[model samples]
Target: MMKRLLLVAGAALMSGLVIAQEPVAPPQVDLEQQQALRDAVSGTSRGITNVMRDAYRNPERTLAFFGVTPQQTVIEIWPGGGWYTEILAPLLREDGKLIAAHFDPESEVAFFRRSRTEFEEKMAGAPDVYDKVELTTLNYDPQLPIAEPGSADRVLTFRNVHNWLSAGEDKAALVFEKFYAALKPGGMLGVVEHQARAGTSLEQMIDSGYVTQTKVRELAEAAGFQLVSVSPVNQNVQDSTDHPEGVWTLPPTLRLGDKDRARYLAIGESDRMTLLFVKPE
Candidate 1:
């Protein structure tokens, strides 16, 4: 009995020693960096209307959840109207690189052409804030690549999944695969999209501009990404996923105009799912 007790004690000590030797994960974003990020989000250059959406978007918290730092190369997919671009460009200008992957300038579609022109004009208007931004083009074509393989530390897309689904399931899958190829091993893809009700059908997901969390996960997993985390930072519990004009019936878009505009305004923005996925190392 004495010998057995000594062996048990020795095993316990060795187990503890091994645990103590295990390396700890360093802090991804320190306190000082967090403060700086917040400051950038709240900066006056973002303009009053853009800043107003901060409460709903929770840009600082969302970026922090995605583990975004100023030093990492970030590719923002389809920065329509430069809403997030206003914050991202200034923050990453000094230490990091910001790549804006926008619609192809040669798009024959009138809306795409107009949007591309407007975005170029916006950047030109604010050269001080946007001059360093590297412009690239991304379209539905799988042959056209967005960024170099394994070159980006992070790939971010906001409210774009539904459009891809509208294009086609295969197209959506191809885009996610492209995102997978753009990131370094262990790098992350951050997605913020309008959230559909749980178990929503693919038809509704495409039509309503709101996608189910499960569907998004399935797509990412199929693209060889592991869903690491989901955040409620941009969630709006008030949205019931039954809007007549779809998610756009809500604020910012207000496609309904003054018809029950007050009601939609009360609900605020559409409920959003903020997800993080990682490429396996």
Candidate 2:
């Protein structure tokens, strides 16, 4: 039947007659990228516990919104537990670079020292997945560059803004400027943090870990970045942002212990705001 149709079309063409044809469908997705993300996120290398959190974290969508590609240099700030590291490591292992700016291993604080040590151990245990990750550290001194100035294609931080702001707004603003300095012109800065209601004071933000979008914008703008977009992929509307322990009272942290545990479990993760900013070219 195909041969017959071809012959008819040829004959029609020879006779100077036009033939009707079906329109080709345009591609709706980048199959290559989709498969890459799927393999990285769903791979057996990730911890089962981290995989279970996929429902709320939505790593795939969040990374996509940040315009992460396989070939760009990405710097992740404060990779405490290496949860995202599991996904990012394999994704960027083959072609791109994943620079983890983690806690200082020599910090006077015991938690920082222990966490960094454990993170190194985790990487050493899984060389096939994590060997290529270039490890670094982030600190309060904005002058201390995380990577070479204007070197990274993307700078990402998850649920870390409140910690920076805890010291004060100046510290947070300086850190934002550092993130800006580490990215190439027009490169992106992706942030995910617990969302606070508008009018929440800076003191409340420092205490609760929930920051207003307005405050985030102010910091980024101070750092010379323009807010390009915001995503709700990680948002939880059920959160009223007034828990006794703030965002920590939700699942994952559940800082309340067994008290009202069921209620916090039902609420799931805290309401989060995901923002993407671009350093101007």
Candidate 3:
């Protein structure tokens, strides 16, 4: 009996050694594919005006940080003026899908009507670039749906949260719920918004076109998402976040219109927060 027990023990030790000796797989890094995506971002087909914002926007790094790959379905909420649309549509045209969740077309607001017209014209003029692009409508109404539930691999929003907040906190929460519903389990939600100073009141956030990081996370968490990570890829340290016209006082908008235009230009764009959240599997 002792000899049999000894043999079994020896065999168990040998099996453990074999298991330890097995090779571990290395983490995957598709360098060639990544380079190709970066090339598309910098391509001249995007035009000069869009290229000018590349430095401030940091499209390549920002999208990479958000885990935006070339082969996944992505939904972009409120793509005002189609700033990111220009890059996203072309990059995803070959292998992936790009869905633009735009404002409700039936709205009587003149700005919404004109922006929709311009966006359609832009898309129409560039069939080669936007042929596969899909369109969906989003509104502040809680009953309205943004995209099909669990359909998108990723949902992205850029500087549009403040506009939702303008409708009120409940509406903003509903919008987040829609985003959460649109993404597949374990999918991502990437947000880039004007960052308010920490501890700013909700009233200030609503008034100044900025939001605290804490508030954003709380909203996401409340909507059944897990905060995955935050990236400083879009941070602008020079922005003081205290202008009379809120974020519009900065460049691009320059709401003051030559009243300290050079100073604001030196400050550059509004300081922004880039957050990545994931739906739990």
Candidate 4:
């Protein structure tokens, strides 16, 4: 609920603006909601492999950290392969809504086209789970907004910051502003992304598929979002963040192909930062 939107300014005020907060506290989840998330996470109907990755992804805690409940209008940006969608689709199926802002199917880029096709097929294949998922795309037109200005309670993006960072900071900032425009007053933008340690250069970040947390903050702040909270629920202490093929060198991607495969599997996924930003009321 937006009821407890305690607007307190953060210390690092920039250009007379400051990050606001609703207080940094662990999100409380009732037994019913907890059980519901667990059920969704453990559901066999979801992609079997996706379920296995919960060890690294921690969907339940991550969503709870974002204060996700069953009664909010949420939009998932670029839900490639619907990894989180498998969990989010059901959690909000009954009382809430999930609008997946995916890639343009009509795009000239082969990768974008394929990604959209696969996601669409996944949704089409799972009618019971995904029939209610409203699909949309961003940046195609100015007149046609992503989620109708100020309509969503939360706009979520997972492991996508690097892709945006690849397109230059100006473009990345604009993308975040699009999200800002999509959210309601006191709405949230939850970003879960592969993280580089502070001071990583933009070029290195883009090349490595990991973004520096500082850059992310700048982009969000530029988009007019207030930093609300950061969660270590997705952090991987084992990851060095200095990989040969970038984050893809880790499991789930494992781009190296037996080039120290066992070692990478042991290290698991890349270290990630889960940040919550608020569109101040």
Q: How many residue pairs clash in each candidate?
A: 0, 0, 0, 0
* Poorly placed runs, candidate 2 (over 4 Å): 1-29
Give the per-residue lDDT digits (tens) of candidate 3, residues 1-281. 99998898889898884233222222122676578569778876687887898889998888887878788899999897888998899888898999999988887788987888788888888898888889888887766677778999899999988888888888889999999999998788999999999999999998999999998998888998877778899999999999999999998999999899999999999999999888877
Instruction: List the pairs of residues colliding in candidate 4.
Output: none
Q: Candidate 3: where is the Cα deviation over 4 Å?
A: 1-29
Question: Could you tell me the lDDT of residue 118 within candidate 1?
Answer: 96
Who is ahead in TM-score, 1 or 3? 1
Error of 3 at 174 (Å): 0.7
Candidate 4: misplaced stretches above 4 Å? 1-27, 140-143
TM-score of 3: 0.88
Native-referenced Cα lDDT, model 4: 0.87
TM-score of 4: 0.89
Model 4, poorest ten-residue lDDT window?
Answer: 3-12
Report how far off residue 38 is in candidate 1 (Å). 0.9
Per-residue alpha-carbon lDDT of candidate 1 for residues 1-281, written as tens digits (9 for 90 to 100): 99998898889888884233222222268997798788789877787898899878999998898888899899999898888898889889999989999988998888887998899999999899999999998887878888989999999999999988998999899999999988998889999999998888999898899999998998898998877778889999999989999999999999999999999999999999999988877
Clashing pairs in 1: none
Candidate 2 structure, TM-score to reference = 0.88
lDDT at 192, model 1: 99
